[model samples]
Target chain A: MLSEFRNPISFARRSTANRRTVALIAGLVATLALAGCHKKVKAAPPPPPPAPSAPAPTASITATPDTITVGQSTVLSWHTTDATSASIEGLGPVPTSGTRTVSPTESTDFNLTATGDGGTANATAHVTVNTAPAAPMAESNLTEQQFEENVKPVFFDFDSYSIRPDAQSVVAQDASFLNQHPNVNVVIGGYCDDRGSIEYNLALGENRANAAKQALVNAGVSPNRLRTVSYGKEKQFCTEENESCWQQNRRAQFTMDQ
Target chain B: MMNGKKQPLYLLLLVCFLLLVITPALRAQDWVHTGTNLGVQHIRVAVASFKPLNNNAQTLPLKSIFDQTLFNDLKNAGIFDMVSPSMIPPEMPGSPSEIHLNLWSAAPANAAMVVFGNIAANNGQITVQGFLFDAKNPTTPQILGKQYSDLANDEATRMIAHRFADEIISRLGGGINGICETHIYFVSNRTGHKEIWVMDYDGQDAHQITHLGDVALSPRVSPDNTRIAFSALGRDGWAIRMYSLTLHRLVYFRAPVGNSFSPAWTSDGTKLAFSASGPSGNNEIYTIGANGGDLHRITAFRGPDVSPVWNPKTNSQIAWVSGRTGLPQIYIMNSDGSGIQRMTDGGYAVSPSWSPSGQFLAFAWNRHYGPGVLGGQDIYVMDIASKRWIEVTHGAGNNDFPSWSPDTRHIVFQRDNQIWTMLSDGTDQQQLTHIGQNIMPNWSWK
Candidate 1:
């Protein structure tokens, strides 16, 4: 027993006071037990008391609005048990049961960690923030994509920015839509076919955009709410080198702010 | 007996003296001979991989880049029948002493001209020594030997190659500057929206110059290559915007609301002419001083008049597309909006680009622009003096907006949403950009 206590690894693990007590107990036991001297009797020491284990903390987190558009806020409510302290990564340290409101521009996951005597418990709540033309100007009835589809492009004649008679109805429809949605701003985009130089087509397209814009203003849409741009034969809808493709290209488009 | 021995020794000394005097004279006579290629023949050239002068971290990498760049530039010059490097003999010549011209001129190589150079990159500086040799001539092989140094980087090394190649072309190709150093500014939608991009004339070192992240079109680099003027779709509508190349920032040009497109730089770089939709009305040509103020309206018409370009040579005249006659046609006028004359007699003509020499205007015109025309539009070059037009590109694709090279020897135009360059005589058409839809290619003047 005394030889066993002298082992370096076991001696290192034992506290200095524990080591001394162990040595003294072993020496006394060995000395008394070996008095008969017929055969050496082994000293069997009792084991130390087991430590009490604390339970792991439990945590739960839920978001008030699990889904949101870009620039909208959501609240995360959390509750924890058996935890000394709790924290969220983005929100920093928080009380055991509290809520945090974050208006993340993008979709993000909020993780809550509750730490206690035993270990830490983690719970995550995700907010799905979608990216569209999102925001104050968006309508519940229509999305930005649907708005673009509703305002059809007005086509033009070859080498001309003058709006064709066929395209007037489309421009009027776009104007009516704008009248209903005064909060929304629209950019009128003019485009030309791949017929002329990019610079020339750009001017041509700008003229086309302005023509559509003039029609909208004539139909009572505010000029301040509308802007114009020319793609100048830069962006094309089709790649075919035919008249059919060219006809599809020459037009005035619209984009609305959400 | 002593006198006889002295006589023989004198004869030997005389022989040595005669050989030395005659060899240099013979070499000079052979070297000074004028060498010219046969009628309309390609100059069969060989570009040797650059020899590194020192062993440094940048030496090997820069040497390979310089060599490869020079080789590609020469090959793309379109006037050369390049002898493949693999077929040429393995001799990395840095100087005349190391070159054996016979190895280049012989057998499978058959190289008429050879370009060899040494390169070194050290202490953030690059030193390049390039030599062009007419190997067909035995005596005086060296035609041009130039040394160029600049801040060491991939761009500088490529510039060195461009400058050296230009020198070779100038000495050989009847004095036309190589387009190697020229830059092509175009609009690309690679990053999801139309933004300005600039690249080497041979479509290398392509990068976005504008991060507007919006639609920007018709990028026109200034004559001095300092700024790029383009139209951007901002909150207030399409406005002309200038980006300073030196400052690496956007410059405010105070363009009118929804009115600016197709910015053109005057020859002196003093003024910019652009067609603007004036007064929320029809398209008109306008000129503004480079420093912004002094806006001069050049034309006001019922129909759209656009794509104004200054006559680079005179700077006194301007050419643009005017639609007064219903269909757009090429029109040339004096700088102060005087001397207006129609350059194109009829048929849809737009995007008139004045030649650098001021002798001709290259534009996109479809003689039969009516529906069912096989070719929707093609590039046409009309001499400003005679007004005689020649079709530069036909069918293949709808080609338009032909901008001239500084030398007036080549024209770059946009076709099928891609950029292409061809000689002024309608030959050697080469497509420059491929990835994404590239349009509005404006070649830098220099």
Candidate 2:
């Protein structure tokens, strides 16, 4: 049925029909005015107007701000005087008269259609989203290998989670990085020197990780952005029996994730 | 020849002397090994070289393997004083027709018992016939005669000899069946990563069982000799994994989210107990059915509890290590987590292995160890009846994870980087695995 109606007619016919209706309405108004003068009518709650032949439904949409920077939102408002159901093309059905906040990634045209006893009416609202310059460091999940490299391990004294005087500076540096890249979260892994039971090492590792995470928070990193997991003695960075190797294992490590 | 009365007295004196001499000989004939005497002195035995019945190219080689394996088994039985082959006469006898017990009991080879066997290798198969005899009482019946046939290979030959040797040990070395046929499961890192491996009790035919390219540790072979329970690191963190020895595959266990490891099985092979990091941040002991269901938490101490071992005799008691006392110590509790008792007073102790008889627990402890103490790790055996204990490995490199043999007379443990076995009394320490860093050995139940 829609295909039978040719193109250019939908817009042209609507305009032409609207003009002819206005002229007829002007003539009707003159006649009505004369009747009012003759009858001295007391405007008794005027009888309701007759239903239109094709239920002339109406719709309108407007974007509060036609364009927005990426990640910013824009409010779209729509109102239809005579319509039962109304929906926007890009969005599903919405109330006949209301407003909605939209955050589109690109320029998009939203067509609102209202249908009721009246025929359908359409309107469009264009929302343009501009991409903000790429975040200095794009927010992406770190690869396991990348995590291994970017996160510098923090060493501890023998059987100690207390940050050494020298180690304090290292942690502060880590805090600085975290502050700059607030979008990245980190898991602070605790470790041991492989001298205790695997279970004991696990708890000790937890203490170390918690200690490092606390230090980070103390240095102004968000606590929720840091996670703590104790590897215990299960994973080792060194295998030698010397103090050097043992020192390497007795520490907390920083690993990042998106 | 003299006076009549005097001649009668002389005849009675002569008859009494002969009767006294012959009675002891008759008693000696009836004295045989009935598996009753379990004395300190070793039972001397002789193993004659097997007769090669056919020239199947493998007959000579197989015979040599059988002879050596059987001889070593008896010698290692600890109850035997084996006669050296060089001491036996050059004449080799395999069957009953070719044997003479008198020769074994002779001067140089004073073996109280003798074992002789025959070997025959036919198309891709070999048959071994073994016979044990009492050399002391030649007129007595044969002690044991076993016939075994299998694929004609070095492995089959050694296995055949082990079976024959076990039968002899059972008949002559007391009531316990020798562990010649048993295998010990352990963790080896020679393959670059720790893997579960199996080897004969003597460390022969060592083969990798689980190729789980990760660090698999604390291997405990089940009672039925069909499965192994070990802990490995995986995507789920540390999990207690089960490997089917019979099916030669990994079986699933009802795993917990926290760090789970160190699985132990009940004597009846129906339950497994393990340690997992509990929600409270401390590792606690938990138990589940063998088929991987019906979980029950057995311990909820403030400190870490791990390495559970079930009493093989009662199947009602479990021994494990708990860190509730600051340092890790051994503890025992009933199957339902009742009747909790502390076994070790102080110092670091771990890896408790309950004896098959349910009489003792073999474990590694560092009693005199302190912050800087080196070479303090030693294996100890404590009788449950009395809190008394004896050290097994001393001054040896950090011994741990001692497992009891099926006979309950021997213990296999890890010393430093190798697997070693010794008598329950800590006498004859023999290294089982040498090429790889092996640890956490668990003797099979059978």
Interface RMSD values, listed in order for every candidate? 26.9, 24.0
lDDT of each residue in A1-258, candidate 1, tens digit only: 322322442344356448669989999988877775544333443343232677888999998799998766899999987787899988899987888789988888899999988799999999998887654355666777878778888888776666677887887888887887777788788888865655667677878888898889989999998878677766788778788888899888888753
Q: How do the residues B1-446 of candidate 1 rate in per-residue lDDT, one tens digit apiece? A: 46876998898889989999986775444112111132578989988887899998998988888888898888767679999878888989998889999999997889999998888988989999999999999798889999999988988898999999988878888888888899989888999988999998877889999998878887889888999988786655567899999999997788553567778999888998988877756778899988888888888666678888999998888998887665678899998998899887566788878888788888988766644445468887777787766777776777777788787777888888899987776777888888998887898989
Flag regions of model 2 displaced more than 4 Å: A1-136, A141-190, A196-234, B1-39
Question: Residues B315-394, candidate 2, lDDT per residue (tens digit)?
Answer: 88899987664557899999789999999866678889999989899999877444455645888888898876777676
Per residue, candidate 2 scores C-alpha lDDT tens digits across A132-162 of: 7445655564466755665577898654455
Top-scoring candidate (lDDT): 1
Residue pairs in steric clash, candidate 1?
B31-B140
Candidate 1 TM-score for chain A: 0.46
Cα DockQ of the candidate 2 complex: 0.02
Poorly placed runs, candidate 1 (over 4 Å): A1-198, A209-258, B1-63, B78-92, B101-113, B119-127, B134-141, B148-154, B173-177
Candidate 1 lDDT score at position A60: 98
